[model samples]
Target: MPCRPSFSSGFDGTSDQDAAMEAADPRGSESDGTWEELRLLKPREVRHLIWEQVPLVDASSSQEYLRHHLPGALHLPHGARLQQLRNVLPDLSQPLILYSNAQNRAAALARRLSNLDYANVYVLGGGIGILLALQDA
Candidate 1:
């Protein structure tokens, strides 16, 4: 008789493949307010906002930003560059949108911007993924 593989060697309930599947599943998308928490908007919404001249700031690294970014997004990596931002954005009351690949970083940047007395600062809830998705749709 041939020996059978152990259950652990098989699915075991938790595996990289399983994790990927879970992430891809839309079921979890509703539970977390990630889509709404960051006040995510569709590309059309963003475009409308842009036409309104709302300031859009990309918090991703320079290289990541170079690859692709919103039409009028300005790169402003979080931390150590608050002063530089002040120079370009003199009015703190200006509407600002902050985004990164992940919400954690964008949230951190939003907090920093707020602490610096910049009013009307918002973090794009789902970052670039949601924006791209909307555009694709």
Candidate 2:
């Protein structure tokens, strides 16, 4: 969609330091004891993978999701019942991004997903709001 933000990261090669810096940024996620694997992707980075058919989940309730959400995002309720997520997401190794309005619920889901062995779960940093602003820009 035209709303896709331009990816400054550009899916290009990066140095090991770049990786370390990204990992060190505590803004996106907290250490959850399971390898600290949840990544927080900015709108631009998320846009880079938008066209790649990466799976995205809207961790908001169904009602909230129906009001607005990413075009291809799946609706997976958060907390205690994330097995539904496991059933929907078959591979633990594939890249996955989860988002809600401001990422509160999304963060919880990301941590749980990581705990469940999904190694590549990422939270949309500012959620759909940032995506909208980027699209407008």
Candidate 3:
């Protein structure tokens, strides 16, 4: 898919210090005490691991997800119930990665997944936007 020229990246003008701090503390502004075990991955890192067949879940809004997402990504918007996610993902122990328009949203959901007993959960650090950028580059 062609990159959307006007895509809303959802990135506020935070300083590099702020971004670093957020990375250091995954909970950051969306702290809910459930992300301590969740892993964060860069776009290139994900690309390298594609051969492992890790499932990618798009936690972005349905509209944005449909517009552009990694190949083979499954949609599971952040607002969906944990039960809904569980239904789509039957194997709780399977390793999976989730991404959204921004890090916070996917991180939040990754936390939920971790809390839901999905033992191997990860989030794309800068969300689908960064992955898209990596592909375009």
**What number of clashing residue pairs does each candidate have, in the order they appear?**
1, 0, 0
Clashing pairs in 3: none
The TM-scores of all predictions, comma-separated, are 0.65, 0.71, 0.71
Runs in model 3 deviating more than 4 A are 1-35
User: For candidate 1, lDDT tens digit of each residue in 7-104?
Assistant: 22222333343344235434255676533433444334454566577888889877778887776677887565788888999999998878777545
User: How should the candidates be ordered by lDDT, best one leading?
Assistant: 2, 3, 1
Off by over 4 Å in 1: 1-45
- Provide the global lDDT of candidate 1 against the true structure: 0.62
Give lDDT per model, in order: 0.62, 0.70, 0.69
User: Residues 15-68, candidate 3, lDDT per residue (tens digit)?
Assistant: 343354346555555566455566887655565455467777888888887787
Can you write out model 2's per-residue Cα lDDT over 29-102, one digit (the tens) per residue?
A: 54555335557786656776777778888898777888878887878876547777678888889999888876
Task: Judging by TM-score, tell me the better candidate of 1 and 2.
Answer: 2
lDDT of 2: 0.70
TM-score for model 2? 0.71
Flag clash pairs in model 1.
Answer: 38-125
